[model samples]
Target: MAFGTVARASKRFQAFDLLATLVVVIRHDGTIVFANSALEDALGTSRRTLEGAALGNFFVDAGTLRTAIDGARTNDFATLRYEAQLRRGTQEPLPVQVTLAQTDRKAELLLEMSPQEQQVRQDREVRLLDQAQANKELIRNLAHEIKNPLGGIRGAAQLLQMEIESRDLIEYTQVIIHEADRLQSLVDRLLAPHRRPHVVGDVNIHEVCERVRSVLLAEFPHDLEVERDFDPSIPEFRGDREQLIQATLNIAHNAAQALAERRAAGDARITFRTRIARQVILNKQWWRLALELHVIDNGPGVPDSIKDRIFYPLVSGREGGTGLGLTLAQTFVQQHHGVIECDSVPGRTDFTILIPLP
Candidate 1:
């Protein structure tokens, strides 16, 4: 029955295409019979090509995978797991937790590959987004507390400055009023993300990218490169156009600032890349499809000293930086049920934003 159906099978493989995990079906002799889209992407090959290929040939520790397959074939274990590095055609070997399972067919097996730390970080992103909501409320309450007293303090200081006789005394009152006004401004910025109304509509991500690109280029105008490497097949998704624009702009603006030296030397470059991600998980929910935008730069990367805490309020890497750009960007993306993550080294930095599609 199985052999008869092979010509017309794959009615159920459609569901596996939507799974985040990479899966491949193996024949008893270790030849791959079927591979899902995720597996095809991980291997960077076509399904037709991967079929009938030796499954063990794609791993650095290929022997272990072959052994697991042999064990599964003999019913030694229903599922055997071993850590192996899956070798991509042109990329580095990927660390994955490999699982081998016996299928209903006597010689058939299923192999699953789950990327190691990437999944852990994604899980933590969900947790952080959960914390993001709490932080949002805290920011709102803190802003209101500071805002209510600011007006009174500034008014009192202004009145005292007028009544003071000594010039030094007037100067002291002026400082008081000036400091109060600064704090008020900070409070206003802290409250901006929460108070802004989300104007939802059909938002073309490329349009947002172009808008930000134009603004950034106009500001710098020379000595820097801003490139677009977009996948045109990424369909339009629902989102707030203005908020996404701000999010992208905030990240790109920071990159431009960090690239000041390189910009002056005519070596700075920032690239905007867009792709469609399948089977993405966000904020404890699963999404079959998502929009991915990468803001990459060739500046000195985020400093290691504060790389982990860069998203926290008032944490600034640059002098005189308000440190609110990334914070606000994260908040805006989180509001749209998306996430933003940063990966940085000395010469390369990537700020990636993921938004789920319906």
Candidate 2:
């Protein structure tokens, strides 16, 4: 193929560059005509290097791709689908589901590669989003139901306390009122997200991080250290500034509390890292660009018992924890069309928030 022809072919397939899945256009002879950006990143090679290379060579078992290509060329199948390990330059081979289809041009074929790990992650994200939506409805309805009787109970207890003459009887009424008030507060928190209107405006993510960092330091000034590694190039986007600040603060505060042992030893540390992820997938949607905000801590990782259910309402790993911090944080981020994920191991815990950017 001439150089001009290859450049035009690549330009025509530029739309594939925005996809998170790796894609390449190959000739009937198995020579790659075009490799998208995602494919380049996965192979740890440049498009210029990938083009004109044999597509079958990138797979662990070259025969598998060769056979698939032959099948496609002969019109033996509408589409060939199989799982294979893909070779890369800088890392271990990645397990990917390969899909091959014929393009309109007789000499060209379209091949897509979806990483198995990424597919699983996308499935999990979908499930998490579904569960979050259901939880929000359940929480809002349940909270309202609890709220109605709670007010009556507190008012009745206050009246009963005033009528009681014996100090012991009065103390019991006071206890009833206190317990009712506590329940009311809990119910209020459960409904808080529903009550607040989503205020949208230009929001600088670094400012949100700075505000949260200030709060974390103020609350744990003695031993905790809050560090920032921000990407100044991240432009402001439309979001609720206060909500983002509160969401970030909640995560940071939770980290600080988890670092109790380390804090006493005067070596507790937390970091706020921000970067731009390209051709990303979040909540099962492909994004050309997204902001990746990570809140990392050096405390003992999340408990094994609650690892999966940490975001569920009323779930907590720490004693005396309200268990609503993460739930609220998730709710706030979701309002901005984003998702929060936690990756934790011994000595390190990272909470990543992904939101699409314009």
Candidate 3:
């Protein structure tokens, strides 16, 4: 019996779908026999559609994958590894690392795809974590340093106002008091994230979405619309209710603000979408399932100038923005051991919060 014939007779392809890495099983002639969910997602299609399709159909530059599969079938190497680009449906081709190996069963060759950008994202995550921790310490000390003297300045200004006979001089003292109060408020926001510890319990993800939706609609009832696309099957998980609310609200509010032009066009929208993710890796740990809450906006995307620094403390993309909203939202989500990521383009921006679910 030929090795290819024996491989075609094997029946364990389903096990490959549970893996986190994108996987595809192919025949000796470059026909795709099976594709795991990860691979299907990469190809932007269903398994049924992917099966029987030519493996080279999805790669713009198929040279590397073609040679790798040939070597895997011929046993040139135990594994053939190379980099290739995967073409998506009407989207940019994705850069990925391809690994090909022969299966124990006959001529069945297994191909694994890992996004090349995953490494870059991981490196960026590490740096962000480090930056976040350092920012926390700086905020704690600076809030105190500014907060302690702020009250004294305000009190002295008030005392000066009381002692001044000239009404014009009294107005100057009032200005001093008002500016001091503004600074005090800013200091309070800087210290906001550290004000409380996690109050964890079973939290219904939908409830959080609804609450934020109501709040946003009440605030922007003119032309803004908050839409919900929820998956009811998503189970309750342990999280801080108030923190989740605040974090989600910050994102939604920012989206609404960005929709100023869209609002004028009478089509501003913010979508609160919840879905379940399986076999996910987050913050360098594996989870069976995770909660994916996406705050999607149909507005001008994040400005390119401050796109990368949007989460940094005191960095605001809008006029009169304190720039503390996203920072606090990130801090709260991090407290729940989740990570938030944003992807933006011209008219769409998605702020996705991933929290591991039990």
Candidate with top lDDT is 2
lDDT for each residue of candidate 3 in 36-93, tens digit (9 for 90 to 100)? 8788877779877777778898888877777877777677899877888899988999
Better of 1 and 2 by lDDT: 2
RMSD of each: 3.4, 1.4, 4.9
Runs off by more than 4 Å, candidate 3: 1-19, 22-81, 85-94, 98-113
Task: Indicate whether candidate 1 or candidate 3 has the larger lDDT.
Answer: 1
How far residue 42's Cα lies from its native spot in candidate 3, in Å, is 6.0
State the C-alpha lDDT per candidate: 0.86, 0.91, 0.86
How does residue 260 of candidate 3 score in lDDT?
Answer: 96
Candidate 2, 167-191: lDDT as tens digits = 9999898899889988989998998
Clashes of each: 0, 0, 0
What C-alpha lDDT, on a 0 to 100 scale, does residue 350 get in candidate 1?
Answer: 98
Q: Identify the superior model by TM-score, candidate 2 or candidate 3.
A: 2
Ranking by TM-score: 2, 1, 3
Q: Which of the two candidates, 1 or 2, achieves a greater TM-score against the reference?
A: 2
TM-scores for every predicted model: 0.83, 0.96, 0.76
How well does candidate 3 score on lDDT at residue 345? Answer: 98
